[model samples]
Target chain A: MIEEGAGQVDGTIRAVLRDVLGLTQDRVNAFDESTPLFGLLPELDSMAVAGVLTELEDRLGITIEDDEVDGEMLETFGKLAHFLRKKALL
Target chain B: MLRFGPQDGPVVIAAPALFEEANRTRAFLVRILRLLGVHGIAGALPDLPGQGESLLPTHQATLAGWRDAFATAARHVSAVATVSIRGGALVDGPAPVSALWRLSPITGAEQVKELWRIRQAAHDRPKLRYDPARFIAELDVEVAGNRLAPGLLAAMNIAEPSSDAPVRTVRLDTNPRPADLKLPGRPLWRASEPDVDEPLAQALADDIAAWVHACVA
Candidate 1:
């Protein structure tokens, strides 16, 4: 069983954004839950998008369905964090 | 645990190149081993460090790193025969495919370089960014190939047949299976798109199957 903590999940997302996709923490953390990742980050191309999602799935130990993802959910850092927290349970 | 059969002879593993090819050939490669039957066991291919199913957080893997992974997997498998699709360069040795592309190069490597080049230059008159072109040009000057990192060059160079460890090849197609496989003139290779008359696609699936069987047989 995985441990609890929305904060921990936030840390995981931040790490993947920084290391795998090579984004600065300042760049990622600046936006709230409504920021659009695909629109904002030039690096967030299809490969990087898939890669970041894959990294999250691995760390969280849960598979994310394609249908579950909508453009609106990942609009901001906070929303992405919230979505991940929910996904971790799923 | 999907245990491969006959703890003797050699092990055959399918190693394809990146992106679309890997996704396209994965299932067909697996089927090839199944067809091989008692010849060899095409060992399971897990995702690379940063790609496919084995994604891990805080990990960014390079091609050389992937070579090490392949080496590790090869060592772990217990068999007299081992097979890999486009993995010959890593297993055998690095050789450039620049010459092959001299006439008509449509391999993924070329496409990647092209896309990256466009992105680097911001699509300005199809010229890559000054830094990358200069960087790649310098690297190209060092190697026999042109405009590529040494590591990438090595990865692209698979035309060189494997002689380092006695790996075998069994190129297959309709009406003409590999001479060694000794299958009937009309082999049972599945054709996903016969209507398109794409021999390469049909042969790829069939050849992979034959390669797997050869390893077991």
Candidate 2:
């Protein structure tokens, strides 16, 4: 059950990035913990960051306070998922 | 006003999503209207005051004004149903249409939150915050480039999509909210630039056409 829940969180994060940034499924599927986001992905601009966060909130049924957002949370796909896992899985 | 499809029969008056979402999804909405025309359903998209080509300045627009304007437009078109996308749902509450169809409808509070988030993101300042109640009372408070009136912002904080008529809610499959139906599609409203999703448009048109038929039958 824990494994399934973790997978769901990971999948939700991937989908939010793909949908908000207009990334192809193949591109997002390739994302691992180390896959860099934020500064690296051209599509993940500042505006896109807001879209990503809001979409994540809507999909996961969680509230993300503005204070909780920071560069570290979005530096990599893994970190972002980790942040969401804490909020959603907890 | 943009009209499509047949000259007579059950007409649908569409309310495009508010603010930037409206610009991003205008083409997509137009495509849906055109497809609805092909389905033999007439569609009308009116320019709400202070939006589109209306002469009123953006800062002067109030939520009540938008609702009143939409109702008037629906009356003018003799619309049988009202179709709204996103924040557009907030504007159609008072229309006299027989049925209401909404795509990913959001409450006014959610809409305001999005605007503030966009503003914060644009400035790259995550800590920047405002007390919505107090902030809206200020003059010339612009969020994401649209100068908004205090009354509009205040009303939005408390407004929600109307449930007076039979309502059909459609959402993207990505959204977990309960909906009458959910369709697979990227959110055009979040696109960095204006874009079109023809397949999604086709799916929505089919859904709207079928729903309208069921409602009128």
Candidate 3:
């Protein structure tokens, strides 16, 4: 089971990206804190973002409001993990 | 092909979501169910208003209009049970539908996102353009090669199985992970190419038929 921590969250996020977007395991694992998402990753486009968010919601059991989404929250892999962890807390 | 089984027998309405899934699984599923001794009617639900040789244009379509069409489809064959697949599960349940069988059901948000993704892939866009939430807010986005009106998006957003309904889910796991250890069966949906997965369809047919039989019994 994935434990509650930054490490776990990052790994889970990576897994989701790999599974949902059909990204290679190596490619997803290569994503780190500095790696930009959204505008940066070609696979992490608008529609891909929706799929990612839906998977996140299902796996984490958290409700993400429409207004809450912006460039900042999804800027990087680390940022996405931190955002999800924060939601998990709430 | 809607009516099946003995004369005046129970009819199962096959309500599959529009677009690629409908293109892929509708006919295959219907045929499998018939062989399994289940009366199945595959609904040819139009994704857009003016679609499927209809006279009305898509721009004029509303959420209620789509619901009316589904209700009409269900009425044509007098559906006693509902077998909703993929995004079709998001449609409002037809009246008198006692049992709801969903196969790999997806949310309205997923549908919207998928439409955009398919569009993006089609165009080979360099980056993501449409934000799903904001796109929906615009209330007039193109989806699955058709127009997505405001009302229709609202309906899709709210389309979910009710508490009172007896809903069962058959998740086809294509990429199994440790988290999906509980659900049996390999992911046959994506195992092969060309959209039609006969083995997966057969498994779903058997599962749905058994469930329908038990429900009626």
| Best model per DockQ | 2
Steric clashes per prediction = 24, 0, 3
Tens-digit lDDT string for candidate 3 (A1-90): 335565666776787787556677899988878899889887676656655776677566676764577789989887888889888765
iRMSD (Å) of candidate 2?
Answer: 1.7
Q: How does candidate 1 fare on TM-score?
A: 0.39
Docking class of 1: incorrect
Candidate 1 DockQ score? 0.01
Please name the candidate that would achieve the greatest lDDT relative to the true structure.
2
TM-scores vs. true structure, each candidate: 0.39, 0.95, 0.61
C-alpha lDDT (0 to 100) for residue B51 of candidate 3: 40
lDDT for each residue of candidate 3 in B123-160, tens digit (9 for 90 to 100): 55555454766656765566546665666665656566
Mark the regions of model 3 whose C-alpha exceeds 4 Å error after superposition.
A1-8, A25-30, A66-68, B1-11, B18-56, B90-92, B95-98, B104-165, B169-203
Write model 1 residue lDDT over B75-182, tens digit each, in one string.
565333344443323332222111100101123343344334323323223222233333433433221112233445334432233345433444332112232332
lDDT, candidate 3, residue A26? 99
Interface RMSD for all numbered candidates: 17.8, 1.7, 7.1
Name the better of 1 and 3 by lDDT: 3
Q: In candidate 3 chain B, what residue range of length 10 has the lowest lDDT sum?
A: B185-194
Q: Candidate 2: which docking quality band? A: medium
lDDT of 3 at B146: 68
Cα error, residue A35 of model 2, in Å, equals 1.5
Give per-residue lDDT, candidate 3, residue B126.
Answer: 52
Interface DockQ per candidate: 0.01, 0.63, 0.08
The B-chain TM-score of model 1 reads: 0.49
